[model samples]
Target: MEKQPSSRLGPLEKLRSFKMEKQKSFRLPGSTSFKEKKYKESPGKRGDMMLHLAARAGNLPHVQMLLAEAGEEGAKDLVSKQNLDGETALYIAAEKGHVEVVREILMVSDLQSASTKANSTFDAFHIAAKQGHLNVLKELLNLFPALAITTNSVNATALDTAATQGHVDIVNLLLETDASLARIARNNGKTTLHSAARMGHVEVVKALLNKDPSIGLRTDKKGQTALHMAVKGQNTGMVLELLRPDVSVINIGDNKGNRPLHVATRKANINMVRTLLSVEGIEVNAVNKAGETALAISEKSGSEEISAVLRVAGAVIEQQQPSPHPPNPAKHLKQTVSDIKHDVQSQLKHTRQTEMRVQKIKKRLEKLHIGGLNNAINSNTVVAVLIATVAFAAIFTVPGQFVEQPTPGYTLGQAFVAQNAAFIVFLLFDSLALFISLAVVVVQTSLIVVEQRAKKRMVFVMNKMMWLACLFISVSFISLTYVVVGKDDWWLAWCTMAIGAVIMLTTLGSMCYCIIMHRIEEKSLRNVRRSSTSQSRSTMSISMPSDSELLNSEYKKIYAL
Candidate 1:
C-alpha cells in the first residue's frame, strides 16, 4: 500500500524550501493534514483546486470526474471552497461563461452560501452580470432569485454592475427582477444611471431611465445628475436622451450651481450645446455659483462658436452682478465698498504700469535723438569749414584777372565784373556764403551755450543754416557764370539755379521721409503698448457689482436710521 504524503514532506515541501516572509500551503481537496493560516492569503495565486481549475478551464468532463472522485459530501465542500479573492468555484465558472460547468456545480455546491459567506460579497450572479455571461446569469437567477439584491464589497447591486459595464440584457434582467435595483447608489452615491451616462452608454441609460423615470434626475453626493454626466462626458446621444426624458434636468445645477449648459459651454462641446439648445424648456441663461450664465462662461473662455450658438438659441446675457441675494444690508454695504476698492486698486495698478512703459519708450527715443544730434553737429561743422575755405579762395581768384595796372573805375575784386551788375552780384553773394558758413561753424562749436531743453531745437537751426550756406554758394557760382558769359544766354544761369533748387528740394524730401518713418514706428509702438494694456485689463477682470446693484442695495437702504 502506498503511504499518504505528510503535509510537511509533500508538494508543500517545495513551497517551504524558499526563504519567504510568510508560510503557505497547497493542499489537495479533502486533505486535512495541512495547517490553517488566515484564508485571505490563499494557496499560490489562483488558489484553484482540481475542481475549481477544471471549472474555470471549462473542461466539463474533467470537472465531472473531479466531482466523482470527491463523493457527494466532499464535492459539495470542494465546490463551496473559496479562492484568494473569496470567490467560490461556482462563481468562477459563472464569471468565465462556463454555463454547463456552472449548472453541474450548482447541483452540488452550497447554494445558500456560494458567495454569501461572511467574508465574501461577490456572488455568482454579480460576477456573471459583470462579465456579460447572460446564460449563466439566468441560470443563477432562476435557482436563487434572492441574489438580485446582493451587493458587492462597494455596495453595488447586480444592476449597478451591469449598467456600469453597459450590459443591456443583464441590466434589464436585474431591473425586471427588482425595479428598486435601479435606485441603488454605489461608490460615492452614484446611481447606475449616472454611471451609464458618464460612460456614454446610451442603451443602458435608456433602459435604466425606462425602469425609473425619476432616476434621470437623481444627483450624486456631489449633486451631479445623469444629465450633468452626459454633458461632462460630451455624449451628444446620451445628452439628447436624458433631455427628452426630463427637460427639468436643464435647470438642475451641480454642486457649483453649473447647469448642463454651463458645463457644455465650459468644455466647448458644440454638439452637446446644439442638443441642449434644441430643447425649448432649457434654462439657457441659468447662472452658476459664480453668477455667470452659460453665455457668459462661453464668452469668458473665448469660445465664440459656443457663444454664438447659445446667443442664437436665445440665451440671454445675465445682468452683470454681485449676486442680488445679498444676505444683509451691512454685508451689502461692505461688499460694495470692498468691490469698489478692489476695482480702483486694480485699475490704478495697470495705469501705473502703462505709464511706466510709456516713459521708458520716451526716454529711449530721446536718447536716440540726442545721439543723432551729436553726429549731425559734427557733420555740419565739417561741411561749413570746407565751404568757408572754397568761398575765401574764390574771393581772390575772380572770374577775370586784375589789370596790369589798376584799371580805372575798378578795384581788384571788381576787375572780373568790370563793374558789370552780374559781377557785383557775384562778389556780394560770395561774401554772403562765406559769412553764413563761418556763422554756422561758430554755432556748431558753441552748442554747449544753449540750455539742455533748447539744445535739441538747435540741431534744427544749425541744419537749416548749413543748407542756406549751400544755397548761397550755388547762387554765387551762377552769378559768376552770367558775368563771364556776358549777355549771351543768361537764361542758362537761371536753368543752373533751378537745377540746384531741385537738388535741395530732393534732399528736403528725403529728410522728411526719414522723420515720417520714425514717427510711424513710434506710433506703432504706442499702439502695441495700448493693446497690451487692454489685454492686461481684460485679464485682470473685476468681480465688482454693477453700479445699478450698488445703488439698489447700498444706497437704497430700506429702513430709516
Candidate 2:
C-alpha cells in the first residue's frame, strides 16, 4: 500500500471540516456546525445524497449527471426524495436561488411531487417567493400556474407572502399573472393590500393599487380597510396612496366603529391624525359604535396634539340632538307608555312606604298609650288605698265627740252632731268617697285582661272611676271642715267652701277643656286624612290614562298612518 496521510476524521467529519475551512473567514460563531447538525439529526439526508448535495451547492452539471445516470423513473424518485428537514432537492435548489437546478429537477419529475413542502410547511414556490428568487418563482409559476393561488398552512398565498416581504416586483409579477390575487385574503381576512399597507410597503401598495384600485376599499375581518391599516404604520405616504382611490374610506367605521382618525388618535400618532384630518370631506365628528368621536378618543388617550389637530379640523363629540322630522306616533305612544309605567311604579312605591311609616307610628303610639295605662294602674291602686283609709278613719273619728252613755234620746257610740245638716252632708260624702275608692281598688285587682284592646278599655273605665273617687274625696274633706269649725264659725266654712270650690272647679274645668280639645283635634285629623285620600284618588285618575283614552290615541295614530 502506498503511504496515505494518517487522518482520524470520518467522512461526515471530513465534509464538516471542508465546509468550515472554506467558510472560515466568513463564518459566524454558530454558522459552521449547522450543516453537520442537519446531517447528524436526519437519517433521510443519507438517501438521494448526491442530488441534495448537488442541488444545495447549485451544481447544475453534477445534478444533470446524477439525473442522467438515474433514468426517468429513478430520476423522478430521486427528485421526490426528502431530507430529514422534509425538503426535496427542488426545494433546496429553490431556497438557494439555483434557478437552473430547480428547472432541471422540475423537467423530469412530477411538478406537484417535485414541489412538495418540507417540514417548514413551505414548498419550493413559497420558499422561492419568500427568498425573493424572482427567476425561480417565475419558473415555478410557468411550470405550475396553480401554485400561485394555493395557500399554505396559514391560508396565505404566495402573493400574500410576497406582499408581506415587500417585494414590489414579485407583487407586480404575481398580480400580472393573476390580478385576482389581490383580492385573496389570508385566514385573518387580510388581503395583499392589507399586508402591504400594514407593513408600510409603499411601492408594493402602489403596485397593488395600480392593479385594482377597488381592493383598497375591501375591509378585513375587523372591518378595517387598507386606509385603516395604512394609518397604523408610520408611513404617511402609504395612507395618502390608500386615500387617493377613495376619500370616503377615511370615514369608514370598523366593527368597533373606529375610523382611521379614531384609530390614529388612539395610537397617539400625531402625524397620522393630521394626515387623516387634512383630507377633504373627512368626517372628523363621526361617532363610533361606542358613541365616542375622534376628539373624545383623543382626549381620553391624553394626546393633546392629536386633540388640537382634531379641534382645528372641527371635530366635536356627537351629542343627542332633537330630530327635525316629526316623531312617529307609534313610537311616541310607546315612549309615553314607558314613562307612565315608570311613574306609576314610583308612585306606588312611595305610597307603600307612606303606609308602612303610618303603621309604624300607629304601633308606636299604641305602645306609649299602653305604657301610660300600666303606669296609671299602679298609681291609681296606691291612691285608692290611701283615700279609702282616710275615708274609713274619718267616719269613725267624727268631728263631734261620740256619746258614751244612754241619755234622753242619745245612744251610745253616736256622734254628738249627728243631727246637724253639715254633719249629714259629711256622712253622705264620706260614705260615697269610701265606696268609690273601694270599688276602684276592687276593679284593678280583679281584672286580668290579656288582649290589648280589652285591657285598654278596662283601663279607661277604671281611670274614670278613679277621677270620680278623687272628686268625692275632696267634697268629703270640705264638708268635714264645716262640721269641725262649728255652727257660729259657719262663715269660716263658707270661706273654706269658696277656696275648695275654686280649686276643684278649676281642675275639673281644665280636664274637661283638655278632653274637648283632644276630641276636636282627632276629628280634624280624620277630616284631613279623608281629604288627602280623595285627592290622591283624583290625582291617580288624572295622571294614569284610562283604557278609552289609550284606545283613542291608538286610533288617532292609525288614522294618521
Best by TM-score: 1
The lDDT of each candidate is: 0.77, 0.81
**Decoy 2 TM-score against native:** 0.50
| Backbone clashes, each candidate | 0, 0
Candidate 1 — which pairs collide? none
lDDT of 1: 0.77
Segments of candidate 2 deviating more than 4 angstroms: 1-48, 321-561
Tens-digit lDDT track for model 1 on 246-282?
6888889889998888888888989988988888788
Q: Candidate 1, TM-score vs. the true structure?
A: 0.51
Error of 1 at 482 (Å): 74
Q: How many backbone clashes does candidate 2 have?
A: 0
